[model samples]
Target: MTRITSERHTDILNGYKSGGSRFNEWSREMLGDFTLLKWGWGALSMRWDIDDRFIMPDGVMFGGHIASVADHVAGLVAMTVLTDSKERFRTSRLETNYFRPLTAPVAMIEAKVTNASKTLIHVEADFVNGDEKLAVRINAVQVRRMTG
Candidate 1:
């Protein structure tokens, strides 16, 4: 199976224009300073600068930040399909593989729902900078609990 590249799924921009302001505001509220770069269908993307507020001694984006992006994107994907039905889930597993180091001050992360099922959803996400894939993440199971 061919993996989806970062640029293809999530495009980094100098800013947002096409309703990006609304997305930005919503994402900021949902995820603090971590801005929403873009989102569509079952896909969501974000960015966070390696500023003083979030920097490690070894350098690179914090693991928490990466995880946050994963959760945000996955939640957004769930929201996409969540209509009148009230669906809830307690994520059982979330995993990631850091492929490259981010030397850039800022890094962009994106997540996508590869498969959506009745009881479980499969998701894969990635963090990248410029043209390099920094991290790869996957959420195996999203057990949709019935809310009666």
Candidate 2:
């Protein structure tokens, strides 16, 4: 397995901060992050403020946003692992479970690559609120896009 270099990690973080990439722009526009805490090998973490757009009718965060974050972070981790610039990753499946309503002003997402193969990458992400309460659990499978 190839290891992720520090420069690549920096590029990934900068991509997110600057919204230089299409994925980064979409994620930032949808998920609102105040800080990207970590971008290590096969792992990414972020602290985000609750976007009012993500609020549900009940006045709490929508479950769909949590799922989106999990999937998006998985793709970001896959991007870090990719070697060629032409290569890309897409989510094949995503499963999310909501344990509690997230009403906090801020939340954290910790995403890690659990397993990776030539064709598929498995990832898991957890969403926790400011009080350390587990709000959502996310699992995803990312597939490497085939190219000619």
lDDT of 1 at 74: 65
| Candidate 2: pairs in clash | none
lDDT string, candidate 2, 1-148, tens digits:
6765345445766677554666555666777654666677778788878877788878788777777677767777666666655566788999988998876489888888888788888988888987899888888888987555
Instruction: Score candidate 2 by lDDT.
Output: 0.74
* Top-lDDT structure, candidate number: 2
User: Candidate 1's residue-wise lDDT over 1-148, tens digit each?
Assistant: 2233223123222133243555556655554456656666566676755455454677666666657656655655544443334456656667756676554466676777787666776777776775656555546456667677
| Reference-based lDDT, residue 87, model 2 | 62
lDDT (0 to 1) per candidate: 0.57, 0.74
> For each candidate, what TM-score against the reference?
0.64, 0.83
For candidate 1, the clash count comes to 0
Candidate 1: regions farther than 4 A off: 1-32
Q: Every model's Cα RMSD, please?
A: 7.4, 2.7
Best by TM-score: 2
